[model samples]
Target: MLLAVVLASVVFSAHAQSVPKPKEFYFDEDKTTARPIVVVEGEGEAQVQALVRERDRGRRQLEATAQLAHIAFSDGRTDLGGQLYQQALAQTDAKGTLGRAVRWNYAWDLFRAGQVEPALTRWVEVASAYGSPSWAPPTLALALWRLDRKQEAVAWFGAAVRTEPAVWIDARNFASQLPDWKQEDRDTLAEVLGAWQANPPTWP
Candidate 1:
């Protein structure tokens, strides 16, 4: 009888492990893809460990795959992260908030690794997924600028400037405007803004 109780307790503990509920965990308040890359240090070790266990067992369901993919990136396992991100995206609605969040984080991971062109593609997909979300133009502008696509960059900048010209024109506002971006990203966007001011895009 005592043995049966111990076995049942073990089974209960196994079944009681918390299932991950992944919403748009990587998006900004603006519902745009965020820039901050995931790091193992950002989450609880317990949660990370659980996600890894799920990943190894191939038991990662749709949203759980997203969480494990994020953890994989945080663990510096880039290839594994990419694979898992692909798997999650395949299983989820690619146009949904959760899907965008996964793609955004994947793009960020690529961008951080200096794969800017691929990152740009993913960002463009996300930017166009909605009615050109307010948060995208600035980041897109800077990325295009970085790639020497000056005209396109300026056009993207124009969208942002139109929305918040007062904010975009001043360098002081950039740090606050892009609170989620790294200092380097903010600086590059400032450069793009400066060039756009020198010769604004032509339009109606």
Candidate 2:
């Protein structure tokens, strides 16, 4: 019964996109996820510089720049963010895991800025790549939701959850950004969660 409820309730919204995992910095040894990074708001450029100066190389560095781009977009500096995202893509040829992650971030940024067409175009490129990370499908679902393709969004969510049951935690965390993700969404998502909570997918 709980399983059915979790599936039926699979609540998530497209707006609650994930933050790219920070590649250039680490939490202080004593800190847990409870502690937040507290750089002053609007100093995103400085943060980017700090991350760049940390000597990231190859895919690592590209991901760092992508993280910087994410910070910039979150700070309302879309032009600067776009430039960094482009630079990251250039650095990696946009074909590997980190590269795909960067593309995902770039697509989400573009979608948030209401540049839906370009965002969707970029999303296609990310989806086609080999070894795209776990983040890709949910990010795609979020984009589809924002574009008002609710049914497609739901299907993508199902795929994401099916492929990565651990991703339900992500879905729970990102619940705010999915389609129909109101209180009602929470109720529905509980169904999906209930179903998968005990039987997360494993490699065949």
Q: How many residue pairs clash in each candidate at the backbone level?
A: 0, 19
Write one digit per residue (lDDT tens) for candidate 2, span 17-128: 3322212112122111112222233354676666666426433565567677778787889999999888878876556656665676677678767786578678767655
Q: Which lDDT tens digits does candidate 1 get at residues 43-81?
A: 667877766665566444555567767667667887897
The per-model lDDT (C-alpha) reads 0.68, 0.56
> Model 1, residue 39: displacement in angstroms?
13
The TM-scores, one per candidate, come to 0.72, 0.50
How well does model 2 score by local distance difference test?
0.56
| Model 2 lDDT-worst window of ten | 25-34
Off by over 4 Å in 1: 1-45, 53-61
